[model samples]
Target: MASKQDTAAQGTPVSGGTASQHTTPPKPSADAEDAAKDKKPGTVSIDQDVEDKDHQLPPHPEPLPPQHPSFIHCMPPKNPAITKNKHSVFLAGSIEMGNAVQWQPHMVKRLHHLPITVCNPRRGHWNTSIIPAKDDMDFKTQVEWELKALDDVTVVCFFFDHNTRSPVTMLELGLLAEKHKVVVCCDKRFWKSGNIHIVCGKYGIPYCETFEGLVGLIMKELKKNDLDVDENGKLLSEPSSAD
Candidate 1:
């Protein structure tokens, strides 16, 4: 028979394994522990659902492949007087508040006095963003609006300065040129002013370099249109001395 001391020296067995050799296996790494917690036996994780909770998405939803926007044609309001006068003018320019304020009010007031009807885009006027037009309103819409405003008006009046060469203005120019309207471009600065000069020259449209000169050109056209009528339409030909 073995003595008790001899048995202790060989180590003790509990059930199937040695008691001293057994451990709680060693606590797993944080990642391993989390992974083990996430996984279930014989089942796969839904990866899409997991990713959705952790990710941010775009504001506008992802569009479908081969998408096409529906195209709609729109026209501007018409006035009977524009047809009878046979001279309609469209005024377009930059919305720079300080300097632009000079010509804009003057031009609008002058058009009100004339027999011709004016189609001035009432955007960014006294207040900005009065109407929130979409960025996608195309040149076709602008031109069609002006054209619809005219009954028989054949002429367009506008000035080109640095402010006038914006994308919208360029689009307006293209539309007017296509219709063979005489363009009157003015330049506020020498360098910025010449773009319209070339465009007008290329398209057989008239151009001026100064606001005063443009005013003269407009008067000349109006006089030519009236033929026998008085040059001043119920207003003094020259600016009032009191003003």
Candidate 2:
């Protein structure tokens, strides 16, 4: 009984008024979409099935966790004549390089000539995820070595890279700032450098901007300790004319 004009008026799609044409629902935000797409733990996720094209197996070896390592315990073998001389120059700084560690070798390369040994924390076993109850040898070794290295070092150098969040390094600096011969090199762009600089000034802990400058300060410390560093940065039994 309805007229063509009536039917046309009722069925014709208007600007956001008629339901004749298919109207797509509003899309969700990225976060909402991700939440919906993610398979929460303990939930039945259709995507988890191996037959599902979306399901992918993890790598053969799971990645390791963050490590707070110690190197003082690991000493390389040397000839008896080498004279395993003075204690270590504890390298305390950022070691988190994701899958690999940095900072230690670079510092060692620079300070290798110094009479003191390098007490590097990164040189030891570095699996931090391992529980102590089942396997505590690594934990015990690092803790003991660090305690010894902390006390025995003639000088401690704290190097802060702007990219690293070094909470432990800060603690080490605070502990040794007034108690020991310590030097700090904090990049100006680092979030905590201002606080460190102020602390260094307040406590009279020598501070510098560059790693090379830290080396210069280390040279000065070596001089005070009756040792000398060469122009090429090799530790010398006595002063050289190059100085």
Tell me the whole-model lDDT of each prediction, alpha carbons only.
0.39, 0.49
**Candidate closest to the true structure, highest lDDT:** 2
Q: lDDT value for candidate 1?
A: 0.39
lDDT of 2 by residue, 205-231 (tens): 777655545665666665566665553
Q: Candidate 1, residue 79: CA error in Å?
A: 6.4
TM-score of each: 0.46, 0.58
Model 1 RMSD to the real structure?
A: 36.1
**How much does each candidate deviate from the true structure in C-alpha RMSD?**
36.1, 24.9
Error of 1 at 190 (Å): 6.7
Quote the RMSD, in angstroms, for model 2. 24.9
Model 2 CA deviation exceeding 4 Å by range: 1-83, 97-101, 131-137, 230-243
Candidate 2, poorest ten consecutive residues by summed lDDT? 1-10
